[model samples]
Target: MPIIDKEGNFLAVADNVETISNSAAIADVMAQFANAEILGIIFPTHHDGRGYSLTKKLRRAGFNGKLRAIGPLIPDQFSDLIACGFDEIEISDEQFLRQPLVQWLAAKEISQHSYQNNNSTKTSIFQSRRQKIAANRHLNLVRELP
Candidate 1:
């Protein structure tokens, strides 16, 4: 079980999405939006990726709070992790021991383009991809019309 703050925010841990949904009061925090400050989504294990969806859901729900990934995530997944909307990641002690601060910094250098690139000089792949998809869909619809 996770704790829900009086302000209505709670951790979006991998196994806790259901609980959050079931509790109307807790879920209302996200709807209200103003009260949320930090939202934590747990990854549980290195292989589990449910946190990504949780982050996405929070973003789509208009939660501009500090979204954090709390688990034993490796630096290699930082790109996707960030693109999924996490402001920071918190790993377990064992993972920190396995990959030091230097390694994590190096991971940041591995990618210059995330799908949701926010760097001022770069455009998000999502924007370009959306344009192409819409164009393609229009073409298909035109071809089918006559």
Candidate 2:
């Protein structure tokens, strides 16, 4: 399996990674890997969404360590995986060849303007609109200052 970071850069797989099953209880899994430096969540398949929720849960629980989503996830999921707090993705060699690094990078770029407020760096459509309005208001106020 090849590991890719949030920026779609290939990364050497870390050793001694404690990967937990997606089906396991969040609390139990957290308790087991609380002190782990790096953790992996086994996604099982492309259709499994539990991994996303699990990532969010882990982040909310204050697990500030690195997280990897391991499975056959598609390029389209790259952005959401990061938004869900996953630092890296581990995919089979076949999946990597099929999707390629460019595909993963493109998918992430396409989702840069997503309307979700999940990722801090990526601004939502609502935030963009609010910013525009504020800027316009500020301009109007400036014009009136004359």
Candidate 3:
């Protein structure tokens, strides 16, 4: 659902910082990102992927304040969005009507693993399988050694 409503149920606090540029120095916002009560990144369109990269960068930079994604995004990307450190997603009414909450929730479970170095969830099938194989091998060695 949209983050904000006509009645004002859910909302994001606007930052007082003046200039926020994609290519600007993120160091400039270290203090603001830390001190601000709320912070967010807006994706003008689905094609613009700066938000995804920026979200990870902000979180890593220690922006513990509220992080929200404001744009029209597909339900399938919800998990990645959250994993990248988004607390909530703000989409248009038309987007909500088409996908709805159920669709988003379902999309959240689309993948159990992420190939990205930094993400919300840590469930990678390849990594998981490797760990299991190592554990099983260790167990077999112990059983034979005694």
Best by TM-score: 2
Worst ten-residue run, lDDT, model 1? 15-24
Error of 3 at 3 (Å): 3.4
Query: Deviation in angstroms for 54 in model 2?
Result: 1.0
Error (Å) of candidate 3 at residue 31 is 3.6
Give the C-alpha lDDT of model 1: 0.60
TM-score order of candidates, top first: 2, 3, 1
Please provide, for model 1 over 45-92, each residue's C-alpha lDDT reduced to its tens digit, 9 standing for 90 to 100. 867877777666667776776766666777787666766776666666
Better model by lDDT: candidate 1 vs candidate 3: 3
Per-residue C-alpha lDDT of model 2 across residues 10-44, encoded as one tens digit per residue: 98655778989987787897788888888999988
Question: What is the C-alpha local distance difference test score of each model?
Answer: 0.60, 0.87, 0.66
lDDT of 3 by residue, 35-139 (tens): 765565667787778887777788888777776677777777777777777777678889878877767766665565676544554756677788999999999
- Which candidate has the highest lDDT of all? 2
